[model samples]
Target: MENHNPPQLGNQLCFPLYVIAKEITGLYRPFLDELDITYPQYLVMMVLWEKDGLTVNQIGEKLYLDSGTLTPLLKRLEAKGILIRKRKKEDERVVEIFLQQSGKDLQQKACQIPAKMQEKLNLSSEDLLELKETVQKILNKIQK
Candidate 1:
């Protein structure tokens, strides 16, 4: 068989994944705008909420971001008064982040986002679970 198909990664699964990720992020834009943050910022905030005082690198690891990205993102959060970055006294080089009162306040207003997202995705609970499991399985396999 000729297998007469395009072989570009951009034309395959990666492309849809990229698009879906971007689109979903965009779908979150309106809601996030209310908080004056972007989706990536929201992800960082969520991580900080669960674990306050995470190191910059730790946040990057969790969000799949790097210093180059985290530096600016963290700065923006700091500027927004949502987070504060400080170097450890002992290390002096390791920057850690802590969410401020405004950040915690943002949480109270964001509590409804999950419900809104559920309605937007329109996926049944079973469908959502299966999708999550499938994606996690793929991620686990790929990480190996």
Candidate 2:
């Protein structure tokens, strides 16, 4: 097969991964609309849920996002009343995110999402785990 052409569309892996991620995120759009947040905003909320009061730098680190992306996204989330942004008391230069009562309340609605996503994808848990591991391996390699 050395002389043969490389694998085409049907044999490719990355194309499907990219397409599926985009499509799946699209699926969440309507539901996310009800919450009045975009996919990136939802991601920000999830991160904040786990650890509130993180500096913009810290949130960007976990999300692989930069200030340019986080700043505007955080602003929108703040405008929606889900989060509050404030300058840190100890460091005036730093901005930290704090979840408001509305944001905390959002978790209850957000809990329904995972189950719906699973039903939509219809992938078995084992398959999902394997895919996650494979992607993690690639991320590790790329990071190193």
Candidate 3:
């Protein structure tokens, strides 16, 4: 007779990673709610704040989202007057996203979020940097 070992959730790396991700996002929920945006929407806003007039495909690439998922999110932001999308005049097939006055204004308020989150997490700068570096290393390996 052959003996078999059963899989255990406690032994799986994914289990803890999933829990940590959920908890971290939960920590951001209240802050994001005050900004009237979800985490994913906030990511899009951050990308635009860094550089405006990026194409739909460009935003999708940065966010790791597909057009199907990104379209509705962009539509909601457009309806909220946070941004506007326009097709390129020369290449009608390409669409670009631009931030509005409201979106630019939102950045001023969002500037405080990093400090607030750091306070909430109660982690020292060194600890936070270590965690970020570890996660980036894992992500880099996974991407390959």
Candidate 4:
């Protein structure tokens, strides 16, 4: 007969990953607060900053979010005058997101966040790169 032990929290890989994700997001909180945005909002802004005029569906796909979760975030940003959501004339169903001048200006301030986070983390460049690569690999495998 084979015997199996019950699962233990400490022995699970997910616990540390969950903790790390939460802690890292926590680390970004103060910085994000200064911009009057949250981590998820910052992620959305980052995507828009990289390329403007993306449809809401495109944004959701890139962020691994759904319309239900993303719609409110977009609405909030629009209310804050950071972005604008416009419906395409050709296709009313297509909602595109564009940065307002304020959003573009926000990018100037946000440019410093990465360096600040790096300083706060105190991880060597090599270590940071390795960690990012490892996480990306894991994420890729999970997605597959």
Candidate closest to the true structure, highest TM-score = 4
Please give the TM-score that candidate 2 achieves against the real structure: 0.89
- By TM-score, the candidates rank as 4, 3, 1, 2
Greater-lDDT candidate between 1 and 4: 4
lDDT of 3 by residue, 74-139 (tens): 999999999999999999999999999999999998999999989999999999999999989999
- lDDT per residue as tens, model 2, 24-77: 899999889888889999999999999999999999999999999899999988
Show pairs that collide, candidate 4: none
lDDT of 3 at 27: 93
- State the C-alpha lDDT per candidate: 0.90, 0.92, 0.95, 0.97
lDDT of 4 by residue, 1-144 (tens): 875988899999999999999999999999999999999999999999999999999999999999999999999999999999999999999999999999999999999999999999999889999999999999999999
Q: What is the lDDT of residue 26 in candidate 3?
A: 93
* Each candidate: RMSD: 2.2, 2.3, 2.1, 1.3
Candidate 4 lDDT at 21 equals 96
User: How do all the candidates rank in terms of lDDT, highest first?
Assistant: 4, 3, 2, 1
Pairs of residues at least 3 apart in sequence or in different chains that clash in candidate 3 = none
Q: How far does residue 131 in candidate 3 sit from its true spot (Å)?
A: 0.7
The regions of model 2 sitting more than 4 angstroms off are 1-13
Candidate 4, poorest ten consecutive residues by summed lDDT: 1-10
The TM-score, computed over Cα atoms with residue i paired to residue i, of candidate 3 is 0.94
TM-score per candidate:
0.91, 0.89, 0.94, 0.96
